[model samples]
Target: MISARNFLHFSRGVALAAAVCFFAATLAVAQTDALPSWNDTAPKQAIISFVEKVTKPDSADFVPEAERIAVFDNDGTLWVEHPIYTQLAFALDRVKSLAPQHPEWKETQPFKAVLEGDMKALAASGEKGLVELIMTTHAGMTTSDFQKIVIDWLASARDPKFKRPYTELVYQPMIELLAYLRANGFKTFIVSGGGVELMRPWAEKVYGIPPEQVVGSSIKTEFRMEDDTPTLFRLPEVNFIDDKAGKPVGINQQIGRRPIAAFGNSDGDLQMLQWTTMAGGPARLGVLIHHTDAAREYAYDRDTEFGRLDKALDAAAITGWTVVDMKADWKQVFKD
Candidate 1:
């Protein structure tokens, strides 16, 4: 028989041990659940099943280390793209910010629309206006300097609809998927049509992908000295446009290897999926994120001003691309 103090100490130790075990078990369960935030759907299930099959050793569908490449489009696929392109919105806002210094912009078409908050005129300018806006606001600065501007803007910029930072506007389900693939030895890359320089500033923090892993549309840049400090300055010339068929070209040029998995939302990403499938690799998967949740997010197809999804819709069934309906599949959208 032990003394009363010894008995009490032993009981306390036992309780602590039980508590630790319980906590650990709870944590393990939570972590397991974290990756499957999306509701049961063929696309979500397929994603999980593919990752498990490829990553598990001794599995018939096990993908080798060199071949475990997964690529994702950035804009509409990974985050929200509505009420006009968010990056374009950022560029317009930057144009407004600089209008005070560049008084000539007050009289210019796109710049005038930006300064006066004239959406009608802005839309009327169309792609040419958009190109001019991007060229004027995003270029003529060192890469590092532009990156800092992007970082600053994203930190302060809030989505007009959600009232959240642009960074926080990312899809919760996709983020989990990114983490899940990375955990299973898949090298996740952001093969976006958005500007490479724009995405580089925050992709690592937001998507867990480094700048090198992000391949996208690029503008010309030249090395120059400002105040005797040598830096790379962005030139107002398009080097590449990583959209539609350009997606595959950019991927091939940059990665030099076909990705085993491709995820995208719009027709801009259709060529990427095509390339992934047509390349003829083992156990390839192509997924398209269909925006169907109107309340949680704006939903439009074919007629939408930004990220039109018409062609991709028709191709989904014929090509076997899994179209994920956001309203049905996602248990949650933006992170709380």
Candidate 2:
């Protein structure tokens, strides 16, 4: 018969083995889970199917790694864009901070609207007023100085609705999707309508996309030498608008290769989707993220002022694009 001490030693060995097996199993699950934050719904399945179709060398839809480009919209698609855009919030805050220097701003329509926390008045100011605000606050500075200003603002600014830093408000499912694509050898680019310089300041740290790969609206800049140091000075005039139809134009000028996949959330992205999936040789993927979860995240479409999802909503059905119901497809919203 085995001694009691020998039996105890045997039990210890078994327990250690069980612990190691559990750890191995947990690691295996993690490695296999491409989009853990996404529910195992039709949208998730479609994403996996497309990735597999394009990446599989044996498949007819196989696309080379160099041509497997995927473009994503920044504002609503990657992160939160509700109540007001993050950039607009920054502009409003800048107006308030600069109010002491420009006492006349207190009487100015758009600046006054921002100072008094009057969102309705700000909205009434229209595109022209918005442009004025952007130009006044964003221009007349070196590009490097502007980037530093942006980075500093984002560090202190919190989303009013979430009471969290704007960077922390990125969708968990989308983050996972970006990683999954990168792991599969796809080069992802952010073709947002937001300001390119504004995004380049923090996009790499936040989204793993480098500066040169980002494309967006920009203002004119002049090359100059100040204090024997070369600097690019931002001009108040608009150079390019990367929204709606301009998205396609931006893609053509910035990224010469047509993307095999495109992801976006609003009507601003409609032309982008059309440009990406249409006139395609291999199977192209165009997916739209519909904000349908009200309790977890704001739910508004066709009627919302920001990130409006009207025409794109109707086109998804007609064009056979996969429209993700955020409430159903996303298991989690923000990255807790």
lDDT of each: 0.88, 0.93
Instruction: Please provide, for model 2 over 131-175, each residue's C-alpha lDDT reduced to its tens digit, 9 standing for 90 to 100.
Output: 999999999999999999999999999999999999999999999
Q: Which candidate has the top score in TM-score?
A: 2
Off by over 4 Å in 1: 1-31, 225-228
Checking candidate 2 for backbone clashes, the offending pairs are none
In candidate 1, list every pair of residues with a backbone clash. Answer: none
Q: How would you encode candidate 1's per-residue C-alpha lDDT over 1-336 as one tens digit per residue?
A: 999999999999999999999999999867776456699878777887877787778888788877899999998888888876788879978987887899898888988988999989988999899899999888887899898998899888888888888888899999999998887788999998889988888899999999899999999999888799898989999999999999999999999999989999888988999988766645678999988889989787788878899998899889888899888889898888
| Cand. 2 TM to true fold | 0.91
TM, every model: 0.88, 0.91
